[model samples]
Target: MTQPLPTRDTIVDFIEGIFLRRGAESYLGEAVSMAQHMLQAAACAERDGAPAAMVAAALLHDLGHYTNEMPDDVLMEGTNNYHEEAGANFLARFFPAEVVEPIRQHVATKRYLCAVDPAYFQRLSDASVYTLELQGGPMSGAEVAAFRANPYLEACVRVRHWDDEGKDPERAHPPFSHYRPLLASLVTS
Candidate 1:
């Protein structure tokens, strides 16, 4: 039998299991561990006054990486594990569509941004750039139009920008307990 979907409390337990055990976990190529990277992203969203659901999405955007068991060096091995898609699908079982869709499309938002803004690519971290090529380089004109048609594009972009910012190892942020209520509020069962 399949496991029951996570509730607010158990989700926190899941977070602790998947993220907290690691030591200084590197994100793709970030100096911080996976937990730190996620916390940083959620902190940015909170600082910018994002809605609670968006903040939750930021915090859990890479749930797929943990769930999929993708290695930290997946990018180095020249694979696009499509962690964004994996993450979104997994989260859908627990979150509302509003929350899941942005996680689903955040990586595509990166590609769309690169095709539209020359400077965006310059700001990408080395690991991000490496993954970009794996994600299919920049989007073409047709691809941009297709991406624009997605209703979740704005939210996805916001999460993507915060994903970029979340790489910092030294930023101050609240602990996981601070977000528990928000997760409970957003989860629909």
Candidate 2:
């Protein structure tokens, strides 16, 4: 049986009291807020002509990090495990497969693409590079071969790109408050 959805007030309180605490300075870097980062990723996905589900996935990809404090070891290891997986797991109860799967597989996709596409890893931020090593580095030839064989490769790649682009602070996107409507819709439906 499906679990009951969280109330809109509950979600808002969580986002405010937990996720977006300190006005984005604490969670985000010198420039952007967590909300801004998420919106930028969603915009990037939209610009790249991704599907609605994928865009939503991009928008909510980091939800877990804000909602729960993840382990530093897991964050550093970069092993197909991290905030993305955590976020996906949390979202699965409320969202459909199309949304959850993309979030779940985003990190793996990033790793796979970095392994196969030489140019991909080159563009990663210094932070991402350091974390990649902990996450087990790039996939092996055998791993890449197997990963590329998956049907969701394209979506994963798009999500990964957006994931990177979302880091910039200069990008224009809606505040986290904007998603309240969408969140409410999901909860009520």
Q: Who wins the TM-score comparison?
A: 1
> Per-residue lDDT for 99 in model 1?
86
lDDT of 2 at 57: 78
> Cα deviation in Å at residue 27, candidate 2?
5.2
| Model 2 local distance difference test score | 0.68
Clashes of each: 1, 4
Model 1 clashing residue pairs (backbone): 25-33
lDDT of 1 at 83: 75
- lDDT per residue for candidate 2 within 38-129, as digits (tens), equals 77888888777877778777888777664334334333444444677766766665667777777888777878878888899889888778
Q: Evaluate all candidate structures by whole-model CA lDDT and list the values in order.
A: 0.79, 0.68
Candidate 1 regions with alpha-carbon error over 4 angstroms: 1-9, 22-24, 68-81
Per-model TM-score, in order, reads 0.86, 0.75
Off by over 4 Å in 2: 1-19, 22-31, 67-81, 180-189
Model 1 agreement with the true structure over 1-189: per-residue lDDT tens digits:
123445555766665556666524667677777888888999999999999888999998887776434333432333345777667766676788778998988888899999999998999999999989988899999999999999888888899999889988789888777887888788775
